[model samples]
Target: MPEKCGTGLSLLPDVPRPNEPSVGRFGEVLRQYNVRLWAGADLVSVTGTWMQVLGVNWYVLQVTGSSTRMGLAMLVQALPVLLLGPYGGALADRLPVRRILVVTQVLHAVLAAALALAVFADAGLWAIYAVAAVSGVVSAVDGPALGRFGGMVAGPARLGTALAFGSLIHSTGRIVGMAAGGVLVASFGPAPLFLWNAVSFAGVVVALLRVRVADLHPLAAAPREAGAVRAGFAYLLRQPVVLGTLALSFVLGSLGRNYQVTMAAMSDGPLAGGAAGYGLLSAVFAAGTVLGALVAGQRAELTTRLLVGAGLLASALQVVAAFVPGLWAFALVLVPIAAAAVLLDTTVSARVQLDTREDMRGRVLAAVGVVGSLSGMVGAPLLGWLSEVAGPRAALAIGGAVCLAACGLAGARLVRRSEPAVPAALATA
Candidate 1:
């Protein structure tokens, strides 16, 4: 059974309920009409997003012909999330999430279309950079709003299952979109792929409009006020489990999960596999994430223990990957490494959502977005430099070791902390 916090919301459940349906929890969650619709639309939307991502990266590389410039393009894109994530979360908490989502999706569609037009016009790299920056701003709002909206669509009781399914949807979309984007970009160009992404956003907009408001489990909107974002941080500080999980998430995300940089380095430098090998490794990693999401979706609950354990597993696997003998062996190692990465990611996300109050979920997830952006901004360049200076294998080993240390420290601190996981104010409420 899960423990209820002061807000009367249940935290992570430790076991399956006695009356859980025979069809299985994941299936039961999927049986809901709203869940099905949301899942389907989200799948299409994510697939398109990944396709656009592939197209954008490829276009930037082609225009600049320099990996450093390509990285700068990505960094510009993440800046908005780092700067505006808390405000975005505050918006999610204060307004109707569905409305916010609808608006953001429309903006996304327009932006993608604009990018496609720019590419078709043979615009310079400046157009790509500008689009990426604006898109990031939209996503700063969309990301937190979408996170809270999932809870409403599924309701509180089934949120875990819904989120797991969300992860599965993302991984599936990544594989399909990347593979298709690769083929299409080779044949057509980046413009068509961006247009396809623009169309994809419409699927989500339609899905949102069709969902029944009556079926949702909406929280009372937080009153409009100053310091809402600050209050969100205060709330997080008062919860040990959520804070600890976020800390671990930062470490794992920043250090252990830069597989894009690390894997490319391995392929070109250490593994001697080049572009073909890099593509193979990426595909393999995507398949692994799908596998991990399927396994995670079946679980009845997520816990701090599971989060830390997954991180530890992934860290260990990364270390092992650093020493693999050749390209084939390196590719073989990435499967379990990617699996553990998704499991850690899924667990951390579920824990953050489940442990926070309903009204504050968006803000907390906004914090999550900030952490993610920071990790990418900080980690990518660091790892890239490490790969350059110390060798890709050493970069991998050092990153894994750092994550392993962080996880161990987190686990030890959890054991030593005498306070209950719930905030004292919330516990007494």
Candidate 2:
């Protein structure tokens, strides 16, 4: 929302200022040996992760052909985060992150391998759910640890750039993984995708082993305490801005971001296509995310205004997308929708990192994850039912409208807070 000087176009906020370094300053950040190694490993691991995700959703749709079932699958995956994310965060604050991540990566690899075996042996839905449940538990711990460790990769000075680069790779991986999964699923089947994911963990494991632990800017480990989780919650209660950002994430994540369920339905039913089409759509969405992340990384500061504006714009785009007549057109609209989504996410993440003490960052992120997961647990099945009853278009339209209304109310509150107060007598007169 920052107006460019002498330019008529409305440019996004957080663009590098005149005094800022080159737009591609992330290149310098990559010069750090540890960051470079981790980035390479992370890219591979993330790509595999997306591949497995698409494979699972696609398989569920194939077997059940029910949007509700797909939602259930998503719900199962998110339940652990809601239940255990706080404990995970506390552990992250107390543990050596590298050691924790190595164990997590191994656990994921084993899970992926098991999923592949189950699918190959024609395992029942219960088997799939069991794997998902276990994986979710691992993720509940792994998520916070990975998040905290990611910031330490490049240290605080280049944290934004490093994060931006991470987002870029993540999106790029999404694009590659989705496209490849589509092809793999169409030709061989979902089993190969899972197997491939199992093997993909090796890259991250190797990178973790190779990282120079001494180079890390580690936060002091929090001492053992009886009510650590409560303490973390108390800290968030005192930080209104952080709480506001998390609230936005929950609203958007629960209602608007269940694309795994919605998009699958959209692809097969409305778009009249299959897994390949879903992959193409995923690629386009991820492309937008890459652009958004790049723009976000350039900005040295993040403000509430940026977060609100991005949320509003993203919601509006979703509403517009709900009405698009064709798949290609819907894909076109998805770009900006995704861009806004990434812009909002990256800005909030950067703001959180900048504001929170290093020791508390993991716990704060855990709290945020819990909110998102709690919302998703309810929203996924609810939205899926909406899709079943009202159709995908209606689901999209309604969800987007809800998000838009919430963003509008939040933005209004913020604007009122920022407005200069008038004297009571003058207002009455």
- Best model number under lDDT: 1
Per-candidate TM-scores read 0.92, 0.84
In candidate 2 the C-alpha lDDT for residue 359 amounts to: 64
Per-residue lDDT of model 2, residues 1-429, tens digit only = 111111111232433343555556666677789988998898888889889988998889899998668667777888888889999999998888889999999999999999999999999788888999999999999999988888767665556567667788889898888789889999988999999999999999999998898887666567789998888788777766567667777888878777766777788778876888886787788788888877766655445676788888888888888888888998898888877777777666766655565667779878877876877676777777888899988888999999998788778765344323211111100
At residue 291, what lDDT does model 2 achieve?
86
CA lDDT for candidate 1: 0.81
Instruction: State model 2's lDDT.
Output: 0.77
In model 2, the clashing pairs are none
Q: Report the lDDT tens digits of candidate 1 across residue range 255-297.
A: 8998999999999997988999998999899889988877676
Candidate 1 Cα outliers beyond 4 Å, as residue runs = 1-23, 415-429
